[model samples]
Target: MEKSNANPSIECTVTECEYHCQDQQYCSLDSIRVGTHEQNPTQKSCTDCESFELKKSY
Candidate 1:
């Protein structure tokens, strides 16, 4: 896999995300899209990372 520069401002722990920096607990993208699944979301669990993409296995 190719190494990616981690965005210092964006810390992440989802290793399954394609945009996650392979060498660090951070995201490589310049920005990310966050959304909510519920119409009246009121908690952290209701939120979702819309930018998430499954990492392709080779």
Candidate 2:
């Protein structure tokens, strides 16, 4: 498959995630959905990556 040149990049330190490309801190997915755990999120911790998938194998 041809890699999309326009893939939006976001720094990801969660190496345990499946979308995290090996050796790189960038997310491999084309898009991600960010959602807050609470209705009134005031901190970055409140945000969650709904698109995050636990890596079955690393």
Candidate 3:
């Protein structure tokens, strides 16, 4: 998919994520990796965005 900031569908609150755009309100990546850390997830906290990359800037 073409990366565009015009799409105002996804709003990322995690500014520390590298996939997040410079604005810190949108995701640059076309898709995100979502998986659970445990064998069987029963809570929302158990899930993680595996595609999340730490941002070098603050």
Which has the better lDDT: candidate 2, or candidate 3?
Answer: 2
lDDT by residue (1-58, candidate 3, tens digit) is: 3334523555676778766665648877766778998998999899988878787665
User: What are the per-residue Cα lDDT tens digits for candidate 1 across 3-42?
Assistant: 3878898899999998888789999888889999999999
Candidate 2 lDDT, 1-58, residue by residue in tens: 1222223467777778777765766777788899998989999999999988888775
- How does model 3 fare in lDDT? 0.70
lDDT to native, each model: 0.86, 0.74, 0.70
On TM-score, the stronger of 1 and 3 is: 1
Strongest candidate by lDDT: 1
Candidate 3 — worst ten consecutive residues by lDDT sum?
Answer: 1-10
- Model 2 residue runs over 4 Å out of place are 1-8
RMSD for all candidates, in order, please.
2.1, 3.2, 3.2
Model 1, backbone clash pairs (residues 3+ apart or across chains), number: 0
Candidate 2 clashing pairs, residues 3+ apart or interchain: none
What is the RMSD of candidate 2? Answer: 3.2
Candidate 3's displacement at residue 5, Å, is 3.5
Point out the higher-scoring one by TM-score: 2 or 3.
2
